[model samples]
Target: MAKNQVAPIKGMTLPQLELMAAVLGAHLGRHLLDELELERVVYWSDSQIVIHWLSSEKQQNKFIKNRRKEINDLTGSKHWRYVPTHSNPADLQTRGISAKEFEDNTLWFHGPPWITQPQSWPVWKECDTTVLSAIENTETENCSETAKDKRMEPTSNVMDIVQIERFNSYQKLLRVTAYVIRFVDNLRKREDRNQGKLTAGELQRAANMWIRDIQHNIYSTELECLRSRTQHHLIRQLKLYIDPGNMLRCGGRINNAPIPTDAKFPLLLPGKHKFTHLLIQDTHQRNCHAGTGTVVTLLRQRVWIPAARQIVRSVLRKCVSCKKVSGKPYLAPAPPPLPKDRMLDSEPFSVTGVDFTGELHVKSANGRDKKVYICLFTCANTRAVHLEIVPDLTEESFLRAFRRFISRKSLPKIMMSDNATTFVSAAENIRRLSQSVAVTDTLCQAGTVWKFIPKRAPWYGGYWERLTGITKDCIKKVLGCTYM
Candidate 1:
């Protein structure tokens, strides 16, 4: 937005007038003018005014709405949505990324940029304290349409005040003389209208000398007092004479000249009190020393102390109140036990196992579906074991595999595995060992216990996976194929 605009096209500058004239003049069949002639020609185009003057103050901006789609996530399924331009800080944060993740040295994106960024700089910080302060102070933010032009005015003013220019050899007297001439001219016309006209050249010369002398005397005295002073005082005097109300107002600015007072205090601290060093500095010192004690009391009544902001910050930084109560620490639940090397030291006393889906009735890597491999194991006290590559995991095939694996070896005493589907389906029947075909004495013979790891706690099955890897590698070494 445009913050301020004067009425009538004539009030605008050549560039501004040219912009309008180029765009709208084409509609009206007219030509644009130059800056040299702009001041002389007050082009009050009535038809142009009617055409460009907006009836409503604000209109819906569709460009911002179209730009909203740029928020889709680049790396993941995650995406961002349009927060109100004023509400969200997502816009501020999109500044350049650094090698360090989440480093605060870069501006944190606090919200959509309501302000312009630094000149020629594209990024803005997003942190709350920085961005909010930037917004509040009108310092870091405020991408005014004027900043590009702002760089020009101050440079020009400095040049004007300090640059070489020819003047009468009378120097300072030139200005004083000019001012006196106007003042007397004003006075004489008033006198002539009220009384009678002066006829003599001698009388006019005498009057001029008297008036000029008095003016020169007063001006010379003021100049003597001020010429040795800083240019600030000189310029300030000039502005006061030009605009007194502005010179006194807080945060007042005119033609790049800031008032001594201000329209607003940009440095005003936002907290309850100035953040200070003495209040915040970290210290080992206690409030009261090794005392023959009088009551050690905090000043119950408010006390004011003048301190630099650094001091206040230091004090607050180390304040006992801030340390004890300013924030809370987070503590999470304890972790689970680490995996063991083996469940049992000796064979069959304890055990570990692996479980996986057996092959389905689909083509295998070897181009056969006739065989399905289901594998399981137990630690052994006596060398007892079972293994199978079966047709499938149907109860009949499983039982047959068990029967075949144990045809000659000693029966297993303990078994363990991750709780998987076929095993889970058979768990109850295996526990009871009651059905004729299911209740094999070789499996149930030694009071064998079938253990399943705790639900969803695969971490306990670490050894099982390790053994599976070993077994797969062993089989690969023995057979040409990587899988059985």
Candidate 2:
């Protein structure tokens, strides 16, 4: 017979109560002994749910699975008995009562009196032993897989053809071609610097190694054998064979061609790989900003990269030196609409424009040679031009030219010229014309308005400037490059 034991249970559900009973019973059975120091354990709970869970074999939830395993491994579910809630004594500690009430409750101290009598103890009915199957936990799977064809080898048969037909210089092409060859040779030796040219054997081994590495990553499924049609279709179609050196190469086009051992078999490489990038940079730098065509031609002499032209172009596009050497031209914006003065109609010489043009060789009145600057005036509306000769750009000389222009073309309403010192600082001429009441009243009555274009804007006065060009051309025809 087991001694009476009443352990307090709190902060746990009814199912938990049963689980605790099962765990504690298992612990005592393994570690404790009864008559003749032999261990005997009997587990009891008020929860039918826990008793059913323990008895059942299936558990989907990991928490339940772990607990059930422990129970079954230590103490069998047959040892667990279901008691009515009222007969359970562990609830006294969980639901507290006054000390006087506790003292009055004998069940709280010694458990239900029937627990002492084996025949009087509660028995679990068939319905009590009935188990509920835990709904199988369902989870949605989100994994997605897509298949893509891998490019393990060059697709085109004419991989040897150079896309770019021309190169800027032969020396650049030769240097780049050598560098590419040197690069492959170094990789074959798997070392940096000073590795002499690779022989046919060494080159084949390197090419074989590269092909194996690529196939391992991309065409893993197709790597079963050389005869595997699904893998390396292009390599198979070429009737290529791996030499004793393990270098993949094609049989010669002719049965008997005088080809050197190294040149007899060409090495295979991916057209657009890290190796290609290295080759492109090497060739581009050696060629010194060679065109796409030139670089491609050089590259074709040795290895092939797919879309070689596009690759060369892309690589060169990033070359800082290339961009600097062949940059875009500076384009000025189109000529703006003509200003209000030029657009509107007026007298032919009403809105006259003026500019200095030439140093014509003229004979003086005394038959002495002299140089004179010609002030060219053009009508804004009619496009008629008048030229006046002046000995110098002085205010007096310009004033004389102005008077001559006015005398011949009539006193104009407005005059426009560039903001040159000769035109802007004409205070003496302006003062004489405005204040000289003694000389002639015609100067004051002319009411001529002088307008100057923006400073440093020679192009703004394009009307007269174009005329100057024409005048220069006509004079050049007659003078035939004369100094004058």
Candidate 3:
């Protein structure tokens, strides 16, 4: 005979002990007897109550029901044979026999006395189902225990078959979470009017329940201690409390203040909670991609998440809009080396800047009002101005003004102006004149070097424009409100 000893767990009753023995017998039968090709298997237990539990059709309590199911699953009820407490050798180990007495005990070393004689083996009895149900029901009258059983009851749609993918960005994730929360809030409002707004406390409760559902096995003891009203170190240190919503909240000094519902008791959350990223993202978007301080302020108005400034700063740092809007301006490159002409000492009229002024009204010899534009040329080094009036803005009219200015100031070596169409065309015409040897010699005598400023930058030729402004003021005073 092969014997195994198992000490009863503390606080376990005789029925629990009997169930444990049946499980051990099943293990032995599978490992030893089945390997030896034995056909018959019997489970012997001294506790009749355990036998009744296995045979009972109606399960009265959740604990007994679960254990009874396990016992039947491992061994058939027909295999269970009742044994008197005195005849069962397993009881010797249960009551514990002295080592000196156990050295000659046949019941402990071999099998029970009745096991040697097949005719003397205990018989199986049909338990009274009604009497067993009545007795067990009366013994298991615990309201809290029943409530636990209800909580453990498996729902039909408890498991979701589909897979969910994580959101791309933290902001996107929080936006999605906020949308889901809003939807759930709507559903709750439809069910009951009091559930109008989904508070942070309520959201925290949902988050906790979700966490417990997935991580119950790992955090069972901690969560149980938390729910048991024990003096949890965290609860005392953080001033945390579970509201009627069953959410962990930071119970600060805001209870008496005239604050909003969210700030009164913000949800206390773990550092690694998934909602932390989403909350930061949501707050950022809510404030219209605001700065760290604004985002933190807005978030505090609704949820009292910790590291508010840090988390908001982190999320905002990665925010595309915030980066585009508030990113540091690139340091302007060091000013380029000034042009040689502007820096070198030269003759007063040797370098000149030329530009156009508007069409002014001048009385024609035919007694008809005519439009004429002014061409202003200034000596860049000396800041002297020469203004000439032309009829139209064509190359010929501008050439006339240019020839008159050159005649008055002699010829300039370098002349700079904006890249106006007329100036470009006149420069091209002058270059074409240089192709001829006669015209080239004439231009070489003038030593005119035409330079065009960058397009649309009139500030580059401010000297000539300033002279033009003064000429305009003088003309305006002379004309006195005349359309010129």
Candidate 4:
């Protein structure tokens, strides 16, 4: 049995492809042995490098090492042997041949002539050990150098108290950290075991402990200066001090103000720390997603984070509720270019756009007011217009107004209008009028085509619709509240 496949697009060395082929052959041999109940089997290949790799015991790269191990497990290394390229029958299949030649080829159908003779099998010499040992020593030196580099890496100075990153909410972190501290305290004093919902005092102690540890890790140099009575340039302007509980607090000009102590000297916190993120996030939620100014004002009551407004703004931006309430709407893509009818430079009124504008009241001959409508026609290319007054919105009235337009401006090849009911009825009437046998030859030969824009899209007929607006504005300005 034999199998073939195209090579991968990612280039690989020739030796790697050969070893992969050996792996495929080993699997095939194992399957054949189990199905046929054979006593023994052997694997053969044309590449000498693959034969040596199977027998070598030294370590190699991961790609070669893994495949070598699987090939050995399926077919023992001792059973694998080499065959000369000319004598190997598998080579004939890899190198192409004509169909007529392949049909009469005996080497492919039957093995090499020496295969039936037991004593004539090709002998595979063992690879030299001296060269292999040197290669192995070089690989060992490389691995040692990698380990030495890792050992000399620097360590982080920031001490995480209880894995603050694991908790999402600020309240949850405080509660969990408080429980851990209470558990440790109870271990020392077995006589007094305080067991119930955590009291306010216990939660307060947990918050203070967290703040103290964070300050110690990040502001160690500044704290050391304060203890030694020496001012550091970083905090010399802030007038920093250590309180009785060994916590860093800010000292301001309001030392004698008659107000709360927390407002006087709030706890100092680094703006970029993870704990500060959680604190700002919790304050934002507790205030019902208020504005940044409101959240910053509330946070300043107890903790003083440097660059507080900028940090609070970043945290608020990530809030899901705030995003839902204030996010901008998606922008629409640009409008398409104008259609062919509008772009062509044809004769005036060759392609005409029509629409209706009004309900102007006009006095009839009987001296009573009568309602009337205006029909406006615009040239698609020249933008010239023609107007006519009709008594009503019926198709008969519009057909008369249309006849008047064509008589003065000449017949138009294409007529475009909105999808109003009156326009639709008039288009059908015009089609029927053109098909009548009694009509004149000029009207029948013209074969005028009527087109309507898509329903509810007034912008599609803006060529004439804009004229309707201008005509109405002029009429409104000229005849304030009187009938014409």
> CA lDDT of 439 in candidate 3?
78
Worst 10 residues of 4 by lDDT: 128-137
lDDT of 1 by residue, 1-484 (tens): 0012233645654333423432332322222223233332111122221112211122213432222221111111121111232332322333334557555533243322533442432222122111111111231122232233333211112112222133222223233333444455678684544233433443433323332233233334433333233234432432211111111111223323343223222211112321112112212134422111211112111112223343344444544565576546776568665444243456442443535433424466777745456565534332233455666666566556555644544444555666767666555656666445555654445655667779888766765565555665665567644334
What is the per-residue lDDT of model 3 for residues 86-109, given as tens digits with 9 covering 90 to 100?
Answer: 888877866788989999999777
Span of 10 residues, lowest total lDDT, candidate 3: 155-164
Tell me the whole-model lDDT of each prediction, alpha carbons only.
0.36, 0.63, 0.66, 0.81
Q: Compute the lDDT for candidate 2.
A: 0.63
User: Candidate 4 lDDT, tens digit per residue, 1-484?
Assistant: 7887677799997878888888888888999999998899978898877877788776676888899999989998989878888888877877888999999988888888888886999887764321222222232443344345543212222234478878899889889888987887799896978799998988887788788888888899987776554658755656566665566777675655687888887889999998899999999999888889999989888888889999999989899988888987897678789889887888899899998888998889999989999999999989998999999998889999999999999999899999888899999988887877776576766668999898898878887988999999999999978887
Q: Pick the candidate with the highest lDDT.
A: 4
Worst 10-residue lDDT window, candidate 2:
138-147
- Over 1-484, each residue of candidate 2 has an lDDT whose tens digit, in order, gives 2332455554655465556666766666766644357656677878787777787664356756777788878777888887888988766756778989988898877789899899998877756354433212210010011012232333322113322234443334344444454664567785566456545554443334444454344434433344232335654444344444333444344323464543444444455655455567778888776788998887665444457788778777877787677877688899988888887677779898888877777668887777777788899988998988789887778878887988888978778888878887664367556666764576556667789888877888888999977876787689774444
TM-score for each predicted model, relative to the true structure: 0.26, 0.42, 0.40, 0.51
Q: Which candidate is the best by TM-score?
A: 4
For candidate 3, the clash count comes to 1
Model 3 TM-score (2 dp): 0.40
